[model samples]
Target: MDAKVRNNTAHSRYELTVDDATAVAVYEIRDGAIAFTHTEVPRSLSGQGVGSALARGALDDARAAGKKVVPLCSFIAAYIERHPEYKDLT
Candidate 1:
């Protein structure tokens, strides 16, 4: 899982490709905030931290862009809860 996440702005998502499988975190920008709406990781990639990596990358992007975060996706919300360093993003 050395793959780096990329922001696909045209598609409104962050993507991480590993072993030909791609995981995504879908989001929408509203009122200067990035609202994460969904997260998906291939079943074959589950339990391998793909989702966590995606979430961290997305949140880091948001921070870099000076945008707040609205974690509408349950997975993202849970990730933030676990990683308090990103709590201020919400």
Candidate 2:
């Protein structure tokens, strides 16, 4: 199933959903950009591309929001490096 990305204000987090209550990744927005700050996938959901999905979603969201990405998180930095399209916004 496709994942949906939702902002969870109460938690100050973004939720990546596989289904209701199934969050494979979570992130936070800091400064002017989206931060892939925290992430996780269920052991059952491992090796299924959930992390990449979350990264893409977060980056796309940042782009759409007209925000620059700082990529303080290692995974996010690596992802931005790999996807040069996002470098313009860094």
Candidate 3:
């Protein structure tokens, strides 16, 4: 769907919008780290790699900002687990 993830810092979440549906990866900043708390992809956007995109974008942003990652969200944790390149952020 060519969805691009964007960090909505004012709301503390990463968002991906497509076809009028928005997916979000919610997070909280604590102890100088980004802690992903929840992730939700609209059913319409499921099975389309939207979640992975959101997780990847969020993690990449954290890496670029030099912020440690605390992936409290199961989806995000599993994403990182599968992508070993991001292991150092944990």
Candidate number of the best TM-score: 1
- Candidates in order, TM-scores: namely 0.97, 0.75, 0.96
Query: Per the 3 Å backbone cut-off, how many clashing residue pairs does candidate 3 have?
Result: 0
Model 1: per-residue lDDT, tens digit, 1-90? 679999999999999999989999999988989999999999989999999999999999899989999999999999999999999999
List, residue by residue over 19-75, the lDDT tens digit for candidate 3: 989999999999999999999999998999999998999999999999999999999
Q: How large is the C-alpha RMSD of every model relative to the true structure?
A: 0.6, 2.4, 0.8
Residue pairs in candidate 3 whose N, alpha carbon or C atoms collide under 3 angstroms = none
User: Over the stretch 1-88, how does candidate 2's per-residue lDDT look in tens digits?
Assistant: 4667766767755567664444433446677565556566666666777767777777787788898877766877887899898898
Ranking by TM-score: 1, 3, 2
**lDDT of all predictions, in order shown?**
0.95, 0.68, 0.95
By lDDT, the better pick of 2 and 3 is 3
Clash totals for all candidate models: 0, 0, 0
lDDT of 1 at 2: 78
